[model samples]
Target: MSENKGNAFDFKLFKRLMSFTRPYRGIFIFVAFAAIVMSGLAVLRPFLLKLAIDDSIVPKDSEGFMTYVILMLVVLILEVVFQFAFIFYTNWLGQSVIRDMRQKLFRLMTSFKMQYFDKSAVGRLTTRAVNDVETISSIFSEGLFMIISDLLKMLVIAGFMLTQSWRLSLIVFIVLPFIMYATRVFQKAMKVAFEDVRNQVANLNSFVQERITGMKIVQIFTREKTEYERFQEINKKHRKAWIRTVWYNSIFFPIAEMAGAIATGLVVWYGGLNVIGGGAVTLGIITAFIQYAEMLFRPLRQIADKFNTLQMGMVAANRVFGILDTRSHIEDNGTINYTNTKGEIEFVDVHFGYLEGEEVIKGISFKANPGDTVAIVGATGAGKSTIINLLNRFYEINSGTIKIDNIDIKEYTLASLTSQIAVVLQDVFLFADTIYNNITLNNPNITEDDVIAAAKEIGVHKFIESLPGGYNYNVKERGSMLSSGQRQLISFLRAYVSKPSILVLDEATSSVDTYSEELIQTATDKITKDRTSIVIAHRLATIKKADKIIVMDAGKIVEEGTHHELLENEKGFYRNLYEVQFADGGNP
Candidate 1:
């Protein structure tokens, strides 16, 4: 949300934005050509009026009058048709360009490593993708194309005025410099105001989205009154930012109109004096010049306003490209697509830090042989979850090697690597979708039959069938409609249905009641029968039967053995954690 100061628009960024139009160059070229034609047509009507006055009315020729009138009417009709086409096509172009840009940006964001999302604000990123892109749409729709058309109209009208009477044109010319000066002042002021407006709008969107998303927490804490007051303050700033723009409009537009009026009065007075003095000035020339003055000034004023639209579009382009240029995404450099994974995972001298110079996983090395279940038990911040994230390639380790079947994980294509592994996260996120869709994640390859079979295998099929719509029951946003235990069961089924070579369950049964935990235990035993499984849990009871238990403290493993063997060692971290948990009848 950093604002670029001054009236200096980024021409390079503007050019880059225009590059999107390359796909529709033919349409863009036609639109440009239409502007020129429409401008010519706009000027034609005033000329036709001049002809009707001079050659027909003043000369008292009825046939000449009718001929000029009919010609003028034809020009007006043509102008209207082109104007409609121009507006329609320009808007179509704008919507189309933003559509591609939003899709590209979203796809890019999906590929970024976890570090990017961890550091960036979700609400702000959402604004950039949704609100900012919509603003960029206005550039082509109402800003750039409209400005071009207005400029052309002004230039053509100015030419007509000069040709009709340079003396009358001189009156318009004299008033222009003052108006232009005021316009420049007004435009610079508005540029700053518009930038503030956009910032405030982003702030508003971000605030609303975050607040609503976390409304449960707000209501639980009884912070509704306080949050509402804060919202009013943000809303006030938004209103003030807009009112500043309105204030500028209120001041600058009247100045332009007053100048136009002065030019009009001067033209009429000077032309009357010429007629009284019996000079060459005609009523026809004076009439055309007056119309010419309005055409010239109004378009100029509009150009200033529309130019602001172009500038705002450039601002949006700058922010969008900034994200597109980010190097936070992991490079999928591996040539190998390793699909037939043996689920033999090895971490050798692995080290990682979410933030630079502050290690979270410190040189931890471990192995889970094919079909062996390994449980990771650690205090909070002891890197159990970090290990799971690294194994899934969500974040690259600062230093070390991770391998599956003795092949470096980095040597496998990210897609093939992730496809071979399924993770049921500590926080089970479900989309506001049917249970079937949630399990398959809308993946076309995972059919209803496939999901049902997987659910039955995991022993959750009956529980789901007991729900209102069975497989079709909607979970609502984040599974708010389902209990936490129910959501965890769905997560387990989702992972099982993927038919992965390896499974990692991070605190899977932490939220489950006794009944749900028993279901999970059954599901776990069945699911991990042949495939390698890694479980990170605070509840020691869940991992009692794990083939190997790795106890960690302060990001380093302190003990490694089976749950029974680790408990036998009196000084072992696993033994201490076990005593601490069951003694309190709560998680360690």
Candidate 2:
């Protein structure tokens, strides 16, 4: 995030990236071999031109001329073949690396704690996975090949020039140091410029994503014009960044051209004098030297261009590495008795916070028996959801201990803890897949009968059956194809299918209509009959049948009793919430 950071290309990071390609080392080696062959063949063309000029054209030898012409044709044919092989192998390597990186990143992102997602933007993370990976692919396929071929060509051409005419080669080499210095400066400038471009593009992408996702809010508030102006501002900044990048590149390339031209002009002037003075410089040798001068410039120019691309790739690499570098706030130790868990959950003097010095759950304490239904009721942001999040170990407690079956929760593997717990959140997020797939996401091998039974238990089977595609109905992105109540029903089915020992329902019935809510409540009662349940609800009426109810206010438990006992306390927060709901016509 810092603008003044040094070059984003870290050698250690590249070394780590290369490890992923180790599995396909054979392919990469073959790609490099082909590139070397192609570059070698490319250098042969200039030598053939020199041979034709000195042996055939100069001496008027038709037979020799025909032979040299045939040799040139053969070299061209081999060059084409090697070029094909080079492209094919590098393409294979690039795609394979892309696939490998995507898998690793996807696994890491999914395994990261919820807290990471809470602090990061979805759009930025998505860009790293998709756009950053693509930049790497381009580097491997095109940039890598250019670097190898150009360097090889430069070396071969320099050796040939020295062998033919060391004096002219010396003259051309005089400018080499200056060119290198200029290139180094340009590379540094381009690195900073490209990093700026990448950051600006990411900012623009984030803006677009946020606006699109919140389009409904913008329209409802009649702020479309304001949002458009905001987008224009971001767009203008992106454009300026791109223009600056282009301006730097434009100046760098032309300056490189001028340097090369100066070197060639000096070579031509000096070579003519050597030939005129009857020195060892032949017309063919001088011609080859000129060709070598032109060839030398090519590699320098290519190195410059490759550096620009490498800078962009490094910027992308920095973003991706930043994500991979983040240590998860919560990770389970590989110690757990998953095969036999009694499901006794307890929060003993737990203290927690989302930020330092600001506690969200202050000294909360509770114990749930193996089959108790404990409902937590509170106003929004009163730490109701925070309690359930802690129960699932999505966050680590600042103090005290959360124990499962008398063992600290941290002693259990995260997978073990999460697998034994099912949560139906307030906002259901269904993937763009079939309804059957969404419900069976945790247990893909679940039988069709089990799927139908889980849906029936959540009172969603009838609605699914009514769909034209039945259980195969597509949910679309975020369940946009279904109503809010139907999406909640599907989420309920998903949780029910898992049959977790601990079921946490956070506003699970808030979106459901009265008829569906009644059916789901009845089904929930039956399902939790022998399982521990923790329900967080704003609707006080929904948890009236709970075995125990805890009322929370300002991150502290203020009341604890059965539903009737809490209702009997006229001065309690729970009683006040109940009265307010009843006064609102008992709808909740």
Candidate 3:
């Protein structure tokens, strides 16, 4: 991830980010205007102070003094009003930008192929979409506005100071180079410190999310103490990173303060000498010069602070753009037509590897008619599941062609290919919503009748009906409210609701008890009757009725026949697996 050094702040990526704000250009323009007005108002404060000192206090004109006092009071009120407006507009623009960013990110994430999720961590992606975008929003709202205001204030103050007296202005301006040099050093140190802090913070967030999700496993294994120690190490690293940032800031601020102080002292000393030497300088002009000197350095100090914040924001931006920049190994060619698709599937000498040079499926071929039942049985990691993934194009084959209805799989659009197939995975995940919503997944077109019919077909309707709220009953995260078998049943129902042209059942009944397994087996048989079905089975009994069974061993097919035919051979891998299982008891 750290290799993103070159493209972190790429101009192209920044331009792409800016395009998201195009829709809200009006709000952004309003924010800019408010910032400029607020900066102009800030400049009036120092001028008012000079007026009070030189005109009111140094003179004996009481009548005119009250008018200046009234004018100063009015300017202060306007300053406060404009400051409020500035905050409102920037906040509005920031939130709008964040909303747009989140929507775009989520759309991109979901549009990506499954291979992206396989290679990326869920916690890291979630943090990027949620936390990183929020950080960018804060920078846009407060950090950006502060920068604009500081720059404008500095320019306005410089112009006024030069008008008052170029000699004194020159003395004050000498500190500009020192401030710039000091800020440059601080900026580099702060950037490194903030980058470390950001990395540590992400690590801590990932650790917490993983632990929370796996809390049951931790308690079950009695490894709470071990997990706590691991968490402590990560937390300590984050603390150290933050401490380093604070230490740099502590040193930087005082150096800046002392430099500003020295510049002020020089201005006062030089202006006094000119006055005593009979140079044309009055009390009012000297007072204004001192006021302008303070104004000048104040914005410079803000710029220093803003530089620190900008560095932090850049770190976040780099992480975000890193995600956006990753090109998924599997992507649509944009030429595939998805308007029509047939259900036929064929694998021709397909070879695949999850890692380089280690094939999981090697030169195996098979075909299934539009409505055929094909069963693949193998030991763990023998490539049964990989075949189904290939059929769905979740992974691209290293060699050979996968075709549907005699058309290459790559020629079909991803959406068209996926829409034709439904998979009930071994591990089920249900969102935190009502049973009806979980099944429909918020698809407005899916009616309640459709959900109930799918649930009934999967033999889970009775269990749902027993609940007080029935279809409206809410499931907790990951369906924790239900037992494992119940979750599987609901997942089966959800898959069935889609009514796909093809179905892949991958150990779909492995988690259930004997009674639920019998019920699910019956439901599975009924649902697969006339569909193009593929089953990856570990339990021999579950796939005994398959029309054709292919047994794989070490990434190649070792046997292919009916269940009885393979048992009769007694020399193939399928026969060996059956003997081992039935030898323990009657059947699994």
Candidate No. with top TM-score = 1
lDDT, model 1 = 0.89
Q: What is the TM-score of each candidate against the true structure?
A: 0.97, 0.94, 0.93
Candidate with the larger lDDT of 1 and 3: 1
Candidate 1 ranges with C-alpha deviation above 4 Å: 1-4, 585-588
Q: What alpha-carbon RMSD in Å does predicted model 2 have with respect to the real structure?
A: 2.2
Candidate 3 Cα misplacement greater than 4 A, ranges: 1-19, 268-280, 334-342
Model 3, 1-588: lDDT tens per residue?
A: 344432323345455556767888888787788777776777677777667767777787787778878887898899888888778877787788878877867877776767789777777888888888887776666677778888888888888777767888889888889887887787777767887888887888888998999999999999999999999999999999999989988988888888888888987788788888978666667777777777777777777787667666667766877776676646676356643344677888999998889999999988878777889999998999899888888888899998878888888778777877889888888998888888888878789998887777767889899986999988888888887777777777877887788889998988788877876787787778788889888889888888889999889988888889998986778889999888978855
Error of 2 at 129 (Å): 1.1
Per-residue lDDT of 53 in model 2: 88
lDDT tens digits by residue: candidate 2, 1-588 = 323446535677667667778999888888888877877887788888888989999999999999999999999999888888888777788789878888888888988878889888777887889998888776777776778788888888888788877899999999888888888888788878877788888888888888787788999999999989998998999999999888878888888899899998998899899889998888887788778898898789888888777777767877777777778857667487454356788888889998999999999888888888999998888999999888888887899899878888888788887888999898999999999988898566688899997777656788899987999999888888988777887877888888788889999888788877877686677667788899888887789888899899889898998999998998999999998888958664
* TM-score of candidate 3 versus the correct structure, residues matched by position: 0.93
Q: State in Å the error of residue 535, model 1.
A: 0.3
Error of 1 at 468 (Å): 2.0
